[model samples]
Target: MPLDLPSDSDTATLAETFRLLGDPTRLRILFFCLEAPRSVGDIAESLQLSQSLVSHHLRLLRGARLVRGNRLAKQIFYELSDKHVSGMLADMAHHVREDD
Candidate 1:
């Protein structure tokens, strides 16, 4: 089956998204949020990263629509934006583990 390509601007946006996912820190953060929403402090502590660093990365991820945050009291918990993002992460993980 043939795949239809997106327009140039859309392609650029897609490429930027890939670029964002290419970062190890951002990728780790995404995986951390894969199962459930997590607070910045929790993600930082679990990932051994500074809360500020996690917050910075989260801002970028949120900007790209790769993740979404929901405010609960004074804390904002983040998770994968939708099933599509989760599916992509899962599919990529499977792909990397596949034998040649």
Candidate 2:
């Protein structure tokens, strides 16, 4: 059967998403938030990145809908936007580990 392709706008959006995921720092941040919601401080400390840097990356990730944040009091905790994001990440990780 022939596959249906995305519209040009959707293709551009998907490309943009891939470009956002291409950054090493952003990718690390996404992986860090894979398991559970994490505050900027928690992620920064665990990843050994400055809080400001983490915040910057989070903003971009949030813009791309790759991650979402929930405000709890004065702190906001971030996690993967949905299972689709996690599933894609997991699939890619598995793909990388496969024997060539």
For residue 74, what is the lDDT in candidate 2? 89
| lDDT of every predicted structure (CA atoms) | 0.92, 0.89
Please provide TM-scores, in order, for all candidate models, with all chains considered together. Answer: 0.90, 0.89
> Candidate 2, residues 17-83: lDDT per residue as tens digits?
8898899988888888897899999999999999999999898888888899999998899999867
Model 1 score (lDDT): 0.92
Worst 10-residue stretch by lDDT in candidate 1? 81-90
Q: lDDT (0-100) at residue 82 of candidate 2?
A: 61
What tens digits encode model 1's per-residue C-alpha lDDT throughout 30-85?
99899789999899999999999999999999998999999999989999985776
Model 2 clash pairs?
none
Tell how far residue 36 is off in model 1, in angstroms: 0.9
Give the Å shift of residue 64 in candidate 2. Answer: 1.6
Error of 2 at 36 (Å): 1.1
Candidate 1 Cα errors over 4 Å, as ranges: 1-4
